[model samples]
Target: MIKKLLELSNLETTISLRQKELLELEEKIEEKKRLLKQLSRKVRKYEEYNVAEKEAAVTVAVEAEPDSEKKVGEIARTDLVRLLESGRVPQSVIESLKDKRYSKDTFDLNFPMLREVTDMGKVDELKKDQ
Candidate 1:
């Protein structure tokens, strides 16, 4: 009976050791899962940050033109060239007409004209006429 008791005690000790090992393994797995979750969250935040930065860059690019009036003036200059090319106006007359119209304040003249032309609904009218 004493021998049987010793054997039973040894078996009980072995079972306890196995249970302790299992609990340790479970704790390790839980820690790993928590770490993975934290890493995933960080990755998601980085992705969102990148997306927002790209959107802001695109917005800035869309509105990057410094002076809208200057662009319009350049367009008008090109139109004048086209009109002269089409024989609507003679080349010899064009230079004299430009000198009279522009004078010393040539650069200043067009910005305000461009602004007024844009504000006065002239662009829509011109588009319709075309």
Candidate 2:
């Protein structure tokens, strides 16, 4: 009877150790799953950026212009490029908009104050007004 009791106690200890190990392994698996989700989101963001770059390349080729003259849209983009350095906007959002061309007619309609100041050639006046 004494020998049987010792055997039973040893068996119980072995089972408890295995249970602890199993719990640890499950925790590790959950941590790995979280990491995988984060990595996947990053991959998707980069994929979208790649697609935008390809589209921009095609647009630049189609809208080639002489170096001496600048288009109205080009002028707006040049002025707006300051957003990239302003730190108020996200870098990713600014990068997407930096290469985009804005129509002067659209700008005038949407932002009349901006259009008026830009047209009047008063950079300081616009800044002071804003």
Candidate 3:
């Protein structure tokens, strides 16, 4: 009985020491995380300051120009440049447009009728077979 009691006491002591060490390790881990967060905050602050400095230097050298160079319909230039950038121009219409010698009126659209349809027909045919 005495030998068993002595073994249990030794085991209890070892367990208590291990638990104390584990608690100390957890506290150290939390402290390290706090230090890391502080360091990251400092790094972010310096990055923001560096960016602000560069922006200040760049803005000093930059000058504003008149915007009269841009056309009223900027999307036309965007779309045309996008199409040209893709390098897939293979249509006869585009080739004819590239000819550049045609009269300006050749591109004019002819329209005399304007109609708007808003009705959705039911599940029955409205027109008979011809």
lDDT of 2 by residue, 35-120 (tens): 99999999999988877865664355335444667775674476344433455444433343333232223223322323233455
* Residue ranges of candidate 1 with Cα displaced over 4 Å: 66-130
lDDT score of residue 129 within candidate 1: 19
Alpha-carbon RMSD of each model: 18.3, 11.0, 18.3
Per-residue CA lDDT of candidate 1, range 26-107, in tens? Answer: 9999999999999999999987876666555435433545454567547556644454456644333344334524423544
Compared to the true structure, candidate 1 yields what TM-score?
0.48
lDDT of each: 0.58, 0.58, 0.53
Error of 3 at 24 (Å): 0.6
> Which window of ten consecutive residues has the lowest lDDT sum in model 1?
108-117
Taking all chains together, each candidate's TM-score versus the true structure is 0.48, 0.48, 0.48
Global lDDT of model 2: 0.58
lDDT of 1 at 23: 100
Residue 102 displacement (Å), model 3: 43
